[model samples]
Target: MVILTQACPIQRPFGSHLYKRRRDFQLLDKRSWSLKPLIPRVSEDQDTDYQLRAVAKLLADEMTANGQVIGIGTGVAVNEYLREISERLGDGRLSGVRCIPSSDVSASEAAFLGVPLTTIEDVNGNVDLMVDVADELDLENLAYIVGRGDNGPQANQPSLPRVRQLLEKARVRVVVVDIAKTGRRLGGSVPVLIEANEDIWEDIAEELDDIFIGDAEIRRRSVNPDAGPRGGNSPVITTDGNMVLDVQFLEGLKLFGKDEIYDRIVAEIETVDGVLEHGLVVGVARKAVVGTVVVSAIGEDGQEEVKEESGPRVVHL
Candidate 1:
């Protein structure tokens, strides 16, 4: 839960119109913004759900051997990937693949769909490959921003350090995301998340400004009761009982150098007392499953019709 919401976009992206349900979504500066594009738009008709399946099938081709351990990341598109994997395994085309989910939400969904599941602590072997989602990705630099999901997954990110440890144990890493999620520049009102022990949140919040790249602000996410049980008037807690703080660059935001901006910001933040983890993940994925958009031109009169003309693009990392 990050409370730094930029000014509302004129219209949200096509595939990103999902409703928010978590009670911890209260924004601190609801009207703050940098007057820059938050997320670049794609003109093509986006069928991300379909594209995600296409990518999953491409991944299924790798589950050839028995007892493959796969790492699943959080995001709206993960369900689509899970469904595809479950179907393939059920049909006997794939076999003996146990999944390691990054979040509580992911574990429940994987089990409900009948996908074999295990935890990082229980697994005896390395993960074959990890297929997860990203919030903002710059393919050229292999840069990624994860854990910006709308609701539960946002809270789920406090567990990312554990996921990273497991990711290191994987032979390969892959990120599957709709192409609409990619952006050219690395700055804006993008949130940089932090998780720490609940008792030390205030200390961490006070030190955020020292590490921020520009005019960024931080706020602890609070939960309201009506939204859900785990959510209430108290500040929302991660599954690990940690407090979450969202650091959003408010204005004068700019990120250009390869690792200069990202690395410096992350390094400084990590040095902050009580800070445990942040949302920046870089150079891990060896492959990218990009869901491309194919927009058809308008004919004679002004009429629009959609069709799935292209499949996802698979780029080597």
Candidate 2:
């Protein structure tokens, strides 16, 4: 029964009346475009690499083209999609795709895949599409949370990521997740990652601990940098060189009986002093490509067996 308190009204849920009109991937003007429901849902246990590749391929076909600037994010899913992009580029189906990477990890992967790489600076203009992964998805809410390794924080006076800048930089933000991760349900321990000032992370963590009580907890990511060559003795630093915070919310935690607690919490954290960018991505993802591998039918023994398929259809959300 945690509440947002008067301290943070921006996190407050807008009236249900307003949510009604805006629900269902309507961040962009609903009149602008329409998505085809070509792919259908399969199994709840649809967390497979093959399925992930299937999702990547769909995006590769739909989003990529020659002489386009693409923004790539870091993650296993992005890597797979990059492989698809490379295949297309290598075969000359797609050429001159100048990729803008969000992080160093993405840059390295794109380099290895032999995809032409560029930076936000060298984009020359707006990016054609930015593909990233989501740790969890709330279909009903039409929002997703990033930062679970499935996507991570610190503080003093809170700092906000120049989110406006990112929004202006990338033309379109599309989130891709496997079938299992897409639903009204929230998954994993870390819902959002916040980057904070190093000197005041202790206090920042304490503040979160107070506001988000119960199963909600804050963790600081650490790495040992002094052990040896591949050391692991220092706190993990972001590209911006800030401390990291992992915020976990209890399972099935909801507010206003219908709204997602994770969404609510992201709002509260933003109002806190010394806070920076959080992983709750809102308004960025206009369309989502969710791929599924459905194994149905029982064997002679009455047990369902795994089946292999290629180029599985994707459910566009």
Candidate 3:
């Protein structure tokens, strides 16, 4: 009975002209590719907060029903969704809706929001739904990249393996992001968290560089720890004491068509000597709720005028 329904009509999304839903999609077909140049766009805009709130509200409605046990992910978009769910629970509109947060930050935030919390083990891995956010998303496929952009180690990142396991355990998985985050191809580096013999990490990085089109740099912690790391030589360590290697693609891997390099990497990257996990999430999200931006029109004064309205679209994956 858990289904995604739009509470309101969504404004035409930014990339409607570029992306269309098709049942059968090919990864390497140039004819099937609508791949645009991956330009750097800001996910945070003037209307972003509004759009996020709207997306949060849309998901909260159905997620609250049937006493569902939800799996929450990290980042600001997921935080907003948590806020919406929390408010509904507080007002007595929702009950028996427990949550399993992906990271410590989400867990603390959920506690602060007065939403009851549970674990995957506590629920015996029977999560009704998993809701998360993405850094960049391929609208053509449900594939996405999570985690902050190659910024050493994310303070809020839980065990990457655990996060992946939770996503796999869920009955349904949904990713919510700003429309700006969607594109023809996903950009950014793929983080490889490794736990191996100290001497072999350099060899692994060298091997990764040979396989991919970019450098695979081992991440370092912030030297100052207050104003962000300007330059540091110390390797950034994970909570689990694993080392992180961020494989930054200089030009992007879309030249060979969608998911070519990415799929190959995802399948074989772990086979590398030291890799524990990587951040290239492929086709995991079954649905997405994307927040639209404010539409604009030319005014009488020959100036662009921003409209007050924007909405969220429930995209089938």
Candidate 4:
């Protein structure tokens, strides 16, 4: 068993706990919310599009009219929800609400609908709310393995820094997601992606073997058309002009006793030359609102039963 040591405990932003409680809000309306029965319907068997729709409705309910919303990413799931929200607001109802999209792709889509564009810096330190999709999340509600869309780093560049700075100042931050992402243990299901500098790629890869009990490989990202000709066929690119290495464990490897794994990976690999940001996303969001989709099933007696399954749910944070 590999035991990684912790150099420093992650400090909780002051007043984070208080802000977490205060900011947390539920969007489901008991009166209006309804789930189609599964016995004859089998909604869960069909894909999680309904879950995504539910999440969109929930967001629309929570958002105030004529308010600013910061949207992150251009993934299919995120885009679908954004479209639903836009349609719900329709013409003049949300005219005063400006949507600051994190990625160019998202900005283009939102702009087509007359949604005003704002830079991430515009919402710096004081965004009314932010909605984004994630790759993985753990029990601590800490996110790992992000940046699926080619534009994640750029979109988050301004907003994330300012948000963290404000957390130190106001001491509050909120994150929201679906229940499926809330894993029981860290690293068991979700693979961690480490973004490092391309200069020391080989050295960092070698060090990961000593620090973790799993296989670690650099992430190769293909440049998108919008990124222009400067983008290369490099495997990974860090948010701060670095590289990304995706670490995966052998099948059936439990993530127990790996609390300090990130610390060791950071301490050892960061020492190498040309290393940049690791994919550790702890303390980024102080609070999370996890949305769950409950599919209804009709039993033989013609009664409806709600069944809960993990995954296949749209998330926001």
Candidate 5:
């Protein structure tokens, strides 16, 4: 029954509605594309590794020979996709493909892998396809939780505002995740990570704490034992100089359930004055690729050996 007294309007949801089509190009029109039903591919190798590779290949197939302005997302699975795209670029299967990276780590990986890069402004903010991984994916609604710091603060994860911009501009937004990252219903098992203005982070956290019944805290930097507490020990600052707050939910609380409390809380948080961006990503992905691993055998050495590795499958969102 808690409420935010100074809440602002929640930002409009990011989705196909936000995409702007180029007058001259029909390829940018997502309506022209049709997603196929889930098709499972099985391989006999490292289940996780094979699944990641299969996903990378699937994303590479989305690129046309004429090239595409792709939005590259961060994380390990995404890195594998970048490598796949780079290999295709080297072999001339796809040319003129320019990538707009979502984070510093992704940009660096793309550059190192020889994937052509461009800015959103240079491309006039028109993206053919966006492929990024999700931290927590809602299978039914295609919603996800992003920016939860899988790579740590040094990875320079893109701010929520920037993510919003990229998603808004992209014509086809696709999310990739391992099957383990997905769930039919999202719950309070994960903290809701929020970014707020540095000056007002404490205030924002306090407000969120009240809303969540004292479940919010300002995320701090990890300190090296040898270095002790230095300036690095200060609160973690995002690439945009904003502070991140890890707001937990009451134990045993389930989100996105029958009561739809998740939607209500999200609206409340969005209205909070100093709130910048939040981790909950809903209605942004047009489709998702979920990588699954199946262990088909138990080896004599006590290691899991799959007779066949299950590859990732595409799910229409």
Candidate 6:
């Protein structure tokens, strides 16, 4: 069996807290009362690199078997994290752990580093843990969005679906991310990537009156002399072997309500023929382990004063 493992360096210890507080309530009846605000606090401090290192350690510490397989998703950010993990594992910090990467890019990187690779078929009855970063996560943690890179379609391919299936089989799914990616609302910071079939791409773009095509851009894995237009002239590609249409919203579109907005758009798009997959991820992560770092400076009196600097936190699965 092939073993996949990676290592990353850590500069400090990081942690996050999740708290829920009930607000004051007035009793109107014996069985009913008007409750006030319920607050949920999530706090973390760490840079993108630091959070990735911390996540590697967390995964290594939590993994039970030496020869067990772990799944990693693709992206520039995820690749950095994997590089750190692979480095640490190379130094003997972690042993006998194999990796199953989410994309061709990730698979190539893993193979280059001498890490063993496996497919869903290779580990037919074994447990595989996938750790990936998300573009957005909502308050209830029910909805998530990913595939911000130009390779949305490939990113969602058998890798994502297969990981979801494996996680469901294991009865648990863990997501690792920095705190900045977590918020009460979704899509405010990151734009959603939607994949539509070539046949219905034009029709769907026309039907979604709320969605506007932002720009025409090329979707290439890397720069190639044989490739088509480098910038605006190139065509977009989806992972499912279909064309992609970039959809945007006007400044004042009616997207106030989350459920209503998602329902309306998803329902409309699904009804259209030849729609392969949309970028809406509902109920993605069951649990998130966020990592934050605290930096301390030495004071004049030779004492240390701790200060928090924010960048990104790692969400662990």
Local accuracy by lDDT, each model: 0.52, 0.52, 0.58, 0.40, 0.55, 0.42
Q: What are the models' TM-scores?
A: 0.67, 0.65, 0.69, 0.54, 0.69, 0.56
Score residue 96 of candidate 1 by CA lDDT: 85
Model 4 C-alpha lDDT per residue in residues 1-317, reported as the tens digit of each score: 23334222222211121111111222222211111211111245545676566555544554334665454444455565567657756855554566655455666677776556665456563445455444444534344434434335434322233223322322112233344545633443222233444455554554443333333322333344333211255443434344444444443223222444333333444444444444444432222223244332222243433343333232233
- The Cα error of candidate 6 at residue 62, in Å, is 2.1
Residue-wise C-alpha lDDT for candidate 5, range 147-231, written one tens digit per residue: 7666455555655666667777775666666555566665443333445344555555555544444333323233232322111
Candidate 3 residue 57 C-alpha distance from true site, Å: 0.7
Per-residue accuracy of model 6 over 74-184 as CA lDDT, tens digit each: 654456546656776788766777777666777888888777777666777454455555555553443555554434544443334443444443322344444455665
Better of 1 and 6 by lDDT: 1
CA error at residue 155 for candidate 1, angstroms: 6.1
Query: Where does the lowest 10-residue lDDT sum fall in candidate 4?
Result: 32-41
Q: Candidate 1 on 1-317: residue-level lDDT in tens?
A: 43322222222211132223212232222111100011112435645455555555544653224677888877555676688778878888678888888888888889999999987668765676566666666654456666643435345552566556655666555554445556544443333344545455555565554334235655565565343312234766677666666665554333221324454455555657676666666552233333342221111132322222345344444
RMSD of candidate 4 to the truth, in angstroms, is: 13.7
Give the backbone clash total of model 5.
3
Q: Write the per-residue lDDT of candidate 3 for residues 1-317, one digit (tens) a residue.
A: 11212122222211122222112222332211111111122344645576567557756753347588888878776788889888888888888899998877889999999889998899888887777666677776556776643423367765677668766777555665555667666666667777744666766665454444222332323323442211145555666777767665554543222345455546546657677887777752233334352222222233433222345344454
Alpha carbon lDDT at 123, candidate 6: 76
Instruction: Give the lDDT of residue 141 in candidate 5.
Output: 57
Q: What's the ranking of the predictions by TM-score, best on top?
A: 3, 5, 1, 2, 6, 4
Which sequence of candidate numbers ranks them by lDDT, best first? Answer: 3, 5, 1, 2, 6, 4
Tell me the spans in candidate 5 whose CA falls farther than 4 Å from its real position: 1-45, 63-65, 151-153, 188-199, 214-233, 251-261, 284-317
The stretch of ten residues in a row with the least summed lDDT in candidate 1 is 31-40
